[model samples]
Target chain A: EAAVTQSPRNKVAVTGGKVTLSCNQTNNHNNMYWYRQDTGHGLRLIHYSYGAGSTEKGDIPDGYKASRPSQENFSLILELATPSQTSVYFCASGLWGGANTLYFGAGTRLSVL
Target chain B: AQSVTQPDARVTVSEGASLQLRCKYSYSGTPYLFWYVQYPRQGLQLLLKYYSGDPVVQGVNGFEAEFSKSNSSFHLRKASVHWSDSAVYFCVLSLSNNRIFFGDGTQLVVKP
Candidate 1:
């Protein structure tokens, strides 16, 4: 089955510390996305990439950076963790440029103290 | 700017009853519509999608949705729901800007 897996399913970080959430997909999709889920917000896009060596900003990309160095891996980085960044992060991949479907990872819960 | 609205935040139903989850969008063009289901503590999965051609699309697990161009609504329905059908239902509309916007989601509780 096609799958997107995220490592460090749970994480706890101190303020000002750096946190990295890694995602890997076996589907060999072209579009990768990072989103955070919180109460009332549903899911907000943090960042996305069209392919390796490309990253684009999303609706809520203010405090996050994304990297897609290879086709199978996409990473979301929090340079200096903040309490507000504590939420469940999900990674998804799609093959289509716009009308394609996204396959999502189980998600990673992050906490910043 | 595009947006999706799922009016009902929560809906409770007894098992074996019919169900409907409403979704409306603010796009003028024919948007790519989709319905996704998220089981408790699980990743979101695509239930069904409507790009064009048909107004009524059938999805996985006996779920179906009707797309109305005049009403700007795509409502999901199931003839009879099962206990396992209890999940968070989300509606998504792919916009011309190459982004997909989702509704707040409807939490369905199916009691046996």
Candidate 2:
């Protein structure tokens, strides 16, 4: 089975506070992604990385930034948290940036006040 | 650009009854389709996927999905559902370069 671990299962941040969500994958996948899940919006991609030291903007990258210091680690950063940014975040790793299965992390529930 | 759509937001079914969840896609080329299930407080799990060849593909937990290029749909089906089958189901479309698009998802409720 694929193993993707995310830190800080639940968090509450005040408005304008900085929030960081971390993810680590044991699958040795080359591609990693960060997505946020909302009630009606489902899951929208926030950021993705092809490999170490690479980050790309996703569908909803307005309020988030991503960093990939290594192949196994990916982090999503919220510079200024807001109430609208409150949602569950998920991290995923795939073998490559192609037609492959994605292994997902448990998820992080964030509440911005 | 590729997109996936799940028409139903929620569906309720009794245990041991059959179930079908609708999914539609908007893509010009051949699409890589997938069905994923998410339980409470957990990440999404792949239930099944379809790339090419046979239209019907089997998945874990006795679930299956049929891909219809004619109608641009990939609907999930189960002959008999159990209470454990209750969860959120998402239909996904994978485009080139590993970019994936997901539907809003359909919540399944199974009553015993």
Candidate 3:
């Protein structure tokens, strides 16, 4: 089984506050992704990284930033939190191809007030 | 650009009843499809995937999906569902660059 761990299972942040969500995977996968789950929007990708020191924008990357300092670590950052950003966030790790399966982290529930 | 669609937002069925969840994708390239299940408070789990060749693919927990290139659909099916099968099901499309797109998802409720 693949192992992907996320920190701070739940968080409550005020408007304009900075928030950081961290993810670590032991799978040694080269690709990592950050996605947010909304009630009607399902899972929308925010950011992704091909490898260490690389980050790319996703479908919804307006208010989020991502860092991939190492192959095993990927982090999502929110510079200014808003109530609209409140949602469950998930991190996934996988190989750099369409045929490979992605392993997901448990998820983080964030509430911005 | 690739996109996935799950028209049904929710579906309810009784225990031991047959189940089918619809999924459609819009992509011009060779499509790689996948079905995933998400329980409460957890991440998504891969139920099955279709790369090529056989259209029908079996997954864990008695779940299966059939890929139809003619219709651009990969619908999920189960002969008989249990209460444990109740969860959110998502259809996904993956690109060669490792970018994956997910449908809005269908919530399954099984009555015992």
| DockQ-derived CAPRI band for the predicted complex in model 3 | high
- For residue B104, model 2's alpha carbon misses the true position, in angstroms, by 0.5
Which parts of model 3 are misplaced by more than 4 Å? none
Q: TM-score per candidate, in order? A: 0.97, 0.98, 0.98
CA lDDT of each prediction against the hidden true structure: 0.93, 0.95, 0.95
Q: What is the C-alpha lDDT profile of model 2 across B1-112, one tens digit per residue?
A: 5788999999999999999999999999879999999999999999999998999999999999999999999999999999999999999999776779899999999999
The DockQ for candidate 1, computed on C-alphas, is 0.71
Clashing pairs in 1: none
Off by over 4 Å in 1: none
Model 2 residue A63 CA deviation in Å: 1.8
The alpha-carbon lDDT assigned to residue A57 of candidate 1 equals: 96
**Lowest lDDT block of 10, candidate 2 chain A:** A94-103
Docking class of 1: medium
Question: Residue A110 of candidate 1: its Cα lDDT?
Answer: 97
Q: B96 in model 3: Cα distance from truth in Å?
A: 1.4
